[model samples]
Target: MSKVVVASFVLCLLLLHQLASVEADDQMDRTAEAKSDVSEQKIDCKAACAARCRLASRQNLCHRACGTCCARCNCVPPGTSGNRDVCRCYATMTTHGGRLKCP
Candidate 1:
């Protein structure tokens, strides 16, 4: 009877440990999700557009258009030119003239 009691106690302890591990993992996942949400909403449009327009011939026009696109899309392609495939919103925006809006 005593041996059986010891075995049952050990099983309960193992189950408790497993439950704690699962809870910790769940908490970590929640934290990571929250961080990503915050980051997605806080992209620095100014810096991103500045980097994107660094090599433009018309600096003011490039910054203005890039800023608008970045503000609306919350993203900018990685370099000064091309690579619009990286940001669908930036690539697809149109001006009143039916031309591409972003530089």
Candidate 2:
């Protein structure tokens, strides 16, 4: 029982360290983008969210979800809807039941 607990604690620590490192990498990416002059790579969150949810029947819900996701990831697919390939990070985000969470 003690050995199992020690192993679990170590695993948790390792997972947390990995998460912290990933976050640092993401910050670096954001920093690089800020320093770049590429207009195409600069995400206007409002416009991107609007574009992402333009065709949705539930406009309010779509706007809310898309807005949140866009703000967090700075990405949305280059379309009104569907074809999530271009927005890989957004596409892979999931709810508790593993359904796609981004609008």
Whole-model lDDT values for every prediction: 0.92, 0.84
The digit string of per-residue lDDT tens for model 2 on 1-103 reads 9999999999999999999999999999998897775644658878888877888999999888887777777788878878788878888888789888897
lDDT score for residue 35 of model 2: 75
Compose the digit string of candidate 1's lDDT tens values, residues 33-74: 999988678578889988988888899999999999988888
Residue 58's lDDT within candidate 1 is 96
TM-score of each: 0.62, 0.57
- Show where candidate 1 strays beyond 4 Å: 1-40
Residue 94's lDDT in candidate 2? 83
> Stretches of candidate 2 above 4 Å error?
1-42
For residue 77, model 1's alpha carbon misses the true position, in angstroms, by 0.2
lDDT at residue 1 of model 2 (Cα atoms): 100
